[model samples]
Target: MARKRGLGRDDVVTAGLAVLDHAGIDAVSLAAVAERLDVRPPSLYAHVDGLAGLKRDLAHTTTVEFGEVLRDSVLGRSGPDAVRSFADAYRRWATGFPGRYEMTLLPIAADDDERRAGARLALGAVQAVIRGFGIDETSAIQAGRSLRSALDGFSRLENADNMGRGDHDADFAFLIDLLIDGISQAGTQPPGPA
Candidate 1:
């Protein structure tokens, strides 16, 4: 029994990630994780509050990991170069870790520490690109939203196999370039449109 009960919370999360990767989000459950760990369903309660809690924790973990990829890819880069790098990294991370990447999109409430750390990681990536334009904090935040939306939209579309006709990579590159140019022009534009 001691050997059978050796599983821990991290073990449950690890098993959950495996289930997510092998199957899909819908397939991950407390029972599934327990089965993977060869433990009783009740055993999970000691680790995760419930399925929602487990999923939230997984999402948070995945987001942090994704943020690290963005950080590493965009660091020390600037301007359009940084933008392209960040965009490419985002796509790559999502493609490479589809299960984990999907988790990042799930809406979940995070504690202060999780929220702050995740925000810093996410903002740090955005700031890397925005800093290139010498944008202010407010503008940086706005640009970050735009950047995230574009990347998220593109990744979601691609994941769904929704690209219609053109070459996906070429189209993605074009969009990234367009976004970089748009941000640059926005920086130079007057407060209001003419």
Candidate 2:
């Protein structure tokens, strides 16, 4: 077998993601990634802190990639259009990389810059969509949370093959429509007596 001497941090992360894609997140371990790379687990310590650090790095990578896909999805779009685009793109990203998507949900420590950057990028897209509705920051935050929760929930169910025989596309579109209508209605309402 050829030597794995030049393997770097990225190589480890890439191997980890491949392991995830093939065997799900639970199967991703330092040993598994090292095995995929034909190297000993201890060799990975040069690139990653260990299993936990590998997971965090995977989360950071997937989140950043997801955010970029989201940002691109909403380009030149706003309001309901942007919302729909965002939802569609989000579903695409999540479903395409369900294992990696799960990684993005891993907890990030306070000082984790990569995780923070990835999260901020994803949130910025949502914030932009909310602002397009003329929603204030306080309300936008709530809206963002609601939108994310809905999207994530649906995607998780679908990724798990648990949509229960429903017409998945129709159900997703219906949810997206409901979300858009709610945001639009909220935008048209006056602030509660301040």
- Which model scores highest in lDDT? 2
Per-residue C-alpha lDDT of model 1 across residues 143-194, encoded as one tens digit per residue: 7788999998999888777888889999999999888887887677544321
RMSD of each: 2.6, 1.9
Off by over 4 Å in 1: 1-5, 110-112, 136-138, 192-194
Q: Model-by-model lDDT, in order?
A: 0.81, 0.88
TM-score of each: 0.88, 0.93
Off by over 4 Å in 2: 192-194
Candidate 1 has which clashing residue pairs, if any?
none
lDDT of 2 by residue, 75-106 (tens): 89998999999999999989998998898888
User: Residue 165: error of model 2 in Å?
Assistant: 1.5
- Which residue pairs of candidate 2 clash? none
